[model samples]
Target chain A: MKVFVTVGSMLPFDRLVCAMDAWAKEHSEAEVFAQVGETSLCPANMEYSAMISPSEYRDHFAACDVVVSHVGMGTIITASEFCKPLVMLPRRAELKELTNNHQFETAKWLEGRPGIRIIYSDGELAEAISKSIGSDGGSIVETGTRGKLINTLRQFISN
Target chain B: MKKILAVASAGGHWTEMMLLKEIFDGHDVAFVCTMEMYRSEVAPNRFYAIPGVSRLYKRSIAVSVAKLLFILVREKPDVVITTGSAPGLLAIFFSKMLGARTVWIDSIASIEQLSLSGRMAKKFADLWITQWPHLADPVDGPTYQGSVL
Candidate 1:
């Protein structure tokens, strides 16, 4: 099985790295590809790795059996759009990565909502990834909402 | 057929509210938020900027009270929905006093933990909501609607 892990711009990558190492140690037969930081963490071997660009994100999602990510709106939606089963871990504010703790907020909101899965802990995340190997998971909502979310803004402004 | 003003601090709050954009499809809706680069980037319609307040006041409560009054009088919304920081809490309190229904939705980020704004807004708002089911009732009238966004 091939897994793709894309964590958004959050600091202290050790948590994800630890999860990946543990998963790899458990399933020595699986191939894992991941990118920890953009313009930061150096490339290392699991299967494929790079500090990828936005243009390359879809390809990365498509190539993987499972998607692991941070609790980011764009990342979450994109993972769903591609029908990639997603496992998310929120960056803790106590870790000093964000000004306030909001990722967990996003995680909790997206959890059990159609095609997403929220993993609050590293152990849960590893387990979710393990399940993805056999399970047909993930949700896809209807598109063309760009006009709708925008219209809501326009109407709110006009009113 | 009531006019609802759903106010947030922009960024995550605004984005979260936007998820429910369909609910306001026909209702009269207004948005109030703070002015920061992140807030401006989201570009809310009919946006009102509030002075960001600290947890502890340097001046008197009267001043904050006055600003709160001014906002209530200006918006005159029938209902106020907020996911607060500081400005959002003030909106909830004053909006309620003016006979508007105030619903404070705590940010969804703190699944288990209570945010500072959630704690403060709980005391004065008509309804307090949390994304987490375990937060209990923050106020006598509060309800946890799970996560709206």
Candidate 2:
């Protein structure tokens, strides 16, 4: 089983790296790839965890058993579009890890959506990974309406 | 009567707000944002600058409140629309208190769920817009506008 994790901008890179390292140690049979942000807090481990660029971001999602991420809007929808089972950890405003508590809200919103799971802490993340190991990403998202949303934006801007 | 004050924290929020700039072209339009190094670089419309709110500075709620007062007294917009981070929350809260129509647009990236701001905004907003229908499940009311931007 393959697990992929992406921490987009505005998250605690060090904590993510620690979580990934701990997870990899416990599940040595599974292959895990974690992409830390530009300013990373990555430990010295090339086998399981490493930093990656945005260009290479999508390729891993295609093959992973589980996709873990911070609660960024971009990362969440991309996971859905790929039909990947997603687990998200919200960046907390109280922790000074994010600009605000918006990630908490975003995580709560996606808590039980189809093919998606919200993981509040590092322990929950490990459990989500266990659940997704053998499972394939479920149903495709109907993003056809994204065009309509864009159209609405265009009209809203043009009007 | 449809004066709209769009508030954000620069970057994606500002870019997202720009997507709806045309809607305000025909109405009274104003912009609100935080003082950021990037804000000077981004070419947002002449906007009102508010103190930034973030997880690190949660204690700065007093500063946020003061800034909100300044904005409320200065703009006095009839409606407030936000694609939020933190400053947008201040706008929504003040808008509600001052009797202005409030609309909150959950970001397109919110496919998995509503952000924390979206949840609070959903409660009191005159219209809460979400690009993802799944978000409506947790919203307490029927005022979801289904993604105006």
Candidate 3:
């Protein structure tokens, strides 16, 4: 199984990167790749970059079986496009990870939506990782499921 | 031949704009984004990299708008679309002044309400779209269109 982790560009989300690093050390069988944005957290058992180009970002996302990401809409939507189930960690304003706490609101809003798992505390990262893989057997979302998502977008456009 | 001008900043804003790529197929699509990390992501089409603008950077907003007008005159697009932060709003506002049809698709991450730029767009846009249904409930602002995401 291959896992891709990304914290959106702009802020340094060290906590998420560190948590994933620890998780990967436990599950060495899984190939872990990360786009850590601007951070100094070194992964013990993973390959990572400070930042990546857009095309490189897309290529990594497409290749991964599962993705761990921040609650950035850009990352979430792109992950869904490849049918990659996600474990999302939202940055908190109090933690100085973000300018505001909208990510907290995003996590709350997206709770029951599709194949996403939201992790607030770092301890739950393992459970969410296993759950993401279990939900889809480490496979991408099938085309039929993706088609249905597009249908909803069409309906809204017409209305 | 319909010419469409798509505008946004480089990160989430650009991602949202790209989600609407299907609609721009076969039409002349040109992109204008803040001068940042994306060097040629909007490939195979004409793209303009303009100065960065943000609510936080009030001092530079005017120069950014002036630069945008220069592109507007040169491109002459028939339609304008943006998923915004700050640069997106200026693009749509100027395009509307040039008689282009303008659409504003607010970011899905604005979980509760529309972003401040989305609200400003309501005054002049031909169509206002929100990813959240509740933001369109009052029916006075952006229409609750499902997300392109």
- Candidate whose TM-score is highest: 3
| Residue-by-residue lDDT tens digits, candidate 1, B88-124 | 7878877777788776767655666767778878767
Q: How many backbone clashes does candidate 1 have?
A: 3
- Ranking of all predicted structures according to TM-score, beginning with the best and ending with the worst: 3, 2, 1
The CA root-mean-square deviation of candidate 1, after full C-alpha superposition on the true structure, stands at 8.6
**Residue range A1-159, candidate 3, lDDT tens digits:** 889999976578999899988889999999999999767777778999988888888998888878898888788767767667889888988888876787888899777667788889888999888888846522222223323434543343333
Clashing pairs in 2: A73-B109, A93-B55, A105-B114, A105-B115, A105-B116, A106-B115, A109-B113, A110-B112, A110-B113, A157-B22
Worst ten in a row by lDDT for model 1 chain A: A149-158
Tens digit per residue, CA lDDT, model 3, B1-149:
57788888867788877766676666788888775457577777888888767644678888888889998999898878788877888888888889888878788788787787888988767778787767885557777646654
DockQ of candidate 2 against the true complex = 0.10
Best candidate according to lDDT: 3
* CAPRI class assigned to model 2: incorrect
Give the candidates in order of DockQ, highest first.
3, 2, 1
**Model 1 segments more than 4 A misplaced:** A1-89, A99-137, A140-159, B35-45, B49-71, B137-141
| Model 3 CAPRI quality | acceptable
Candidate 3 or 1, higher lDDT: 3
Q: Per-residue CA lDDT of candidate 1, range A1-159, in tens? A: 887777653344557766776677677777777766533444344643434544466677777778877776656656656778777788777766555767867676676765566777787876677666655545533444345434433343344
